[model samples]
Target: MNNIALSRWTMSYFVTSLAAFAIAQALMVLGYGFPQAAAAAPATLALVHIVALGWLSLLLCGALFQFVPVLTAHPLHSNSLPLPTLCCLIAGTLALVCGFLQLAGDIHTGPPCFVFAAVLLAAGFGLVLWNLGRTLWAARPLSVPARFVAAGLACLLAVLALGIVFALVLGGALTYGPALRLVHAGLAVHIAAGLGGWLTFTAMGVSYRLLAMFMLAPELDGRGTRLGLALGCGALAVAIVGGVAAIGMGVRTSRVLLIAGALALACLVFYGKDMVHLYRARKRRKIELNSKMAMLAQASLAAAVVLFLLSLALGRLGQLLPALVYLLAFGWLSGLGLAKLYKIVPFLTWLECYGPVLGKKPTPRVQDLVTEQGARKWFLLYFAAVWLGSAILLAGFAPLFRISAAAALFASGGIAFHLLRARLLLDVKPELRLPDGVRKPNILYSFSPKASLR
Candidate 1:
């Protein structure tokens, strides 16, 4: 597996994901050609799907394929699955995007596109979760983050199931009826499961390790760690399942559900605060760009929560809620996902190439795979674009929203390309490491001493 040239597949899929994002951006630019609130809905949805499914999911699949074995001290069930997963995701996303575009033009095509995309997405999601699941299941007594990821995969499955139902709605196969109470009631459940379940849980699971490693802090453990996990997992269940059930009962039940949602947000806040505090309390003073870029994402999420809660309190949800959702999905979720991938891709390349060669022969440090200084410029541009695009979103000009969407694609593409470029430039002598941008060493720190991964 180590000698299988996994780097090529990784780089290729990275390109595929970024290309989709760029195309989506270009489409928005051409579709609207002027900023307007009218295009915001489709535009935001397209952008969210592009970032989450195309860029982040592809990147994560590529990465975990390389590292899961290392983490578990076991070889993967099949080393070739990453390629197929990448292909399915890229193909599936394109179909869905086209379906969405056609549907937006007219209600007719929405259903077909939804079904097609759902099928493809399901295949891709299944491959990823299945592989990761098998690996983690075999590795016993997993660490907290590992357990979180194990749980996160469950949420991912729930999200995908709801997502299929959403597709059914688009396909005209279902409607709101007493018989199909599940469909109407399911939308709320879908959103909660998709938004709060898959996306948030997975991010938290990854962040628990990634943030600590980036900041040079120890991985969470003992009681404080247990509390964090318990709060996170418990709240996710309550808000998604319990809250959705409440909404099914009545309006009054719905309000109680909203409070449960509040508690979910509270869990997020504690998680965020703890991560920030961990970073600030770190022994390493010069934090890397990857870590710093994460702050912008965290800030976006913080603002999203505040705006959402404020809207809820002031009874202005109808007017302001869409904008808030946009901020959370694109600004917060997509942004952080992109920032981290810039580092993760190259690091994976390092492992696939140099991991086995470690200690036996002179080898490049993982940092040798990427240039930190180069990464800094792209992150700066990406964050700048995020703030600018978010501001345009707030102004409610639809054409401006389209433009912001374009900027986001360009910025995000730039970072992903930056990863490829970093890899190509790394043709240095063994042990002559290039400086990876603000590398937090702890993400992979849990490698068992007995493992041959290093």
Candidate 2:
């Protein structure tokens, strides 16, 4: 593992993802639902796909490109993977967006493009997972995050397989009645695997280590930490599986989901409490943007738990479930990921371009890339948007929901624009650069891409 962390490509991905997150939010405000384009509804099924595929997928792909190597004690299998991976991903994303347009414009009146786009997205994910798996397996003895990565990958495959099926239905390759039945039977599992498994599971795994790193807290590997992780993921598993069965099975299994959710709730309560304790015990006095943003995330999750418990007790879970999913995706998971990206991107960019110089004559302090105050402001704005947006949606007020979602769009856009430019500025700050610094030096260092930095 590199003594320091993060890479350039990853940094770029983080920048792009923040941009995508903002764009997706803006689209929500604009009322651009996938199948119901007329209503311009923010919560269209296509919107879900955008948050999942465009924002979360891009962010995670970037993270693994960098962090997975550190976690596994391995370099990329080849440097070649990043570009192709990016191409496949961006193209796949385009296809998926097109598919959404087709589905939304008119299911009966839609274009054939949707069918093509979905297949392209499946291809994109396949390439990403395949290369990522190779790198993870090459790491030898797997770390905890690697194990979580495996779970995430497994879920990605599951989600895609189901997505492929849904795509067929959309294309009319499969008849509607049977296709809808299959989707109804399998939709919960598909959603859970993608949302909880692929996204939330990996986030939890990363933060277990990262939160400790940023805060300089005692490492979270003691009995309490392990117990919390096990309980949380374990309980979640039971709830999801049972949740799936409850949908298709009789009322008995449905009853079991209540029990399972309660167990998961217990785990979440402990997990959140532990994180609070960790934050309180930190050696660093003033928290950075990452920590503050994460705290917001913790609060969001707490709200989600409250919603879940209320839903269960009121026997209105069927009605309340979609809102719950909305909170989890935007408020908790995506918020946390986006918050960390602000820190992670700048740090990684510094590492790849500047890390090797640390022990040499002179080097830049890691803090030089971005300031804390600016980041904190962005994070606060983002969280406020999430809270407001979730509340508006839950209230079932279309105009309010549209407005809040639009605010998120603007906030995220500003973050992406500012962060992207600042990263570039960091690379060429006159004070940060040595007098001899240039992209290339004399013949002695001829032809090496990084020769100038040395």
Candidate 3:
């Protein structure tokens, strides 16, 4: 832990990501996408990009900026890169959203926003890969978590390349027959690579380390972890290859995709089993609120897998795909991200403020910076709303889905407020604060001078 350098721009990434999440939720509550429009509708595309690019990608980038070093026991290749990377990502996301709106005939902006968006996104993701890839490369024979991250980075590159081509086709910059065919057939592969390959794979890798650390459990170094990683990578590879072949060569790849999906499910089974073992083997007897809430996220993943398998069996997979996506995006990914942030924000705050003064003076424990009782309800409300919303969406009830989305929005707001409170040290005792000379950390930046703390 001592070897891990602080990521100065990570909090900025987190704050921006949360803002994007709020906007996405607000859009849901307003019925901007999906149930209100076709799944392939422009408005739906805009909303999905807001969640996927603006929220989840940024969140994942922030976490990686901080933890990649922790995983490899090496410093980041460059600390100067994250701020510029964040800027590019934010600009790209906004441009992409506008491009979607332009396609929907909502905004009549000229200049082909999709092209700009794709360029900016490619540059941003390229920087991320360069920085993290070098760091991982410097430490050869990577650990299990690091290997997962490496695989995810490769997927991110694939996602970027596919996305850029899609953007070009949509923006009228690419009208060649092959390009058009790729667009028509590559959507599934693009989505699967981004969501499953990049986001979920990276999250799985980070959780393998973070959950263990938080639980005081042994880090997994066994066959199940290895198998899961291999299968996950294999699944993504198969999906990409099959999709491309179906598009360009006019090949039948349904069986290939089916095999990929089966492998994905198997990957999940192994991961779930490992998580169970992780929890059972924990050295810490008392679980904190973060770990407790993460259980719901794990359960959401399980529920999603079960529902997906059932829908496929019933030949209703297409009908239930949106619900499954909702479950994955909000219930599993967002839920886990928020659960981890509950602890991470406070822990980072503690480290920044009290680390230098430790042993020299009295300081609050990391737990003292937050009140779990206040936050627990918000986590419960969030997961409950997500579950209800997914079910309602599956039932094709738009109005009820919006209502549940409002509940989710409310709960997310509460959770964000709690995280903000932790960041500001607002919940810490005044007596504890006065003796330690602790001050509120910057809410949206991490570049404050160390001298200011003194």
State each model's C-alpha RMSD to the native: 5.7, 4.8, 2.3
Kindly indicate the candidate among 2 and 3 with the higher TM-score: 3
**In candidate 1, residue 98 scores what lDDT?**
65
Compute the lDDT of residue 330 as modeled in candidate 3.
97
The candidate that achieves the highest TM-score relative to the unseen native structure: 3
All candidates in order of lDDT, best leading? 3, 2, 1
TM-score against truth, every candidate? 0.81, 0.84, 0.97
Global lDDT of each model? Answer: 0.64, 0.65, 0.89
Could you tell me how far off, in angstroms, the CA of residue 174 lies in candidate 3 after the best superposition?
0.9
lDDT of 2 by residue, 205-231 (tens): 677667776787765555655565566
Once fitted onto the true fold, the runs of candidate 2 whose alpha carbons sit more than 4 angstroms away are 1-8, 34-43, 106-114, 175-180, 232-260, 426-429, 433-435, 438-454
Compared with the true structure, model 2 gives a TM-score of: 0.84
Q: List the residue pairs that clash in candidate 2.
A: 31-40, 34-104, 35-104
* Model 1 misplaced regions, further than 4 Å: 1-12, 31-48, 67-77, 105-113, 174-180, 243-253, 281-283, 356-365, 426-454
- lDDT digits (tens) for residues 1-454 of candidate 1: 1322233355566566566556656765676322332434554456556756776566556556655554455566665677788778887887766665665673452347767888888998899898788888887878777777766677778777767666667656657553155555555565566666667666766776676755677666656556766776776677566755665564333554576676677677667767777787776688777777888888888888887888789888757755776677667766777777766665665554445446665666656666677767767776676667666656666556665666666667677766765555443453344332322222222121122333
RMSD in Å for model 1: 5.7
For each of the candidates, give the backbone clash count: 16, 3, 0
Query: Tens-digit lDDT track for model 3 on 1-454?
Result: 4446668888999999999999999998888998888999999999999999999999999999988888887788999999999999999999899898889999875778999999999999999999999999998889999999998999899899999999988988889998898898778888888988899999999999999988989999899889999999899888876777777886666777788899999999999999999899999899999999899998999999999999999999889999999999999999999999998898888877776677788889889999999999999999999999999988898778899999999999999999999888889887776355555578876633331111
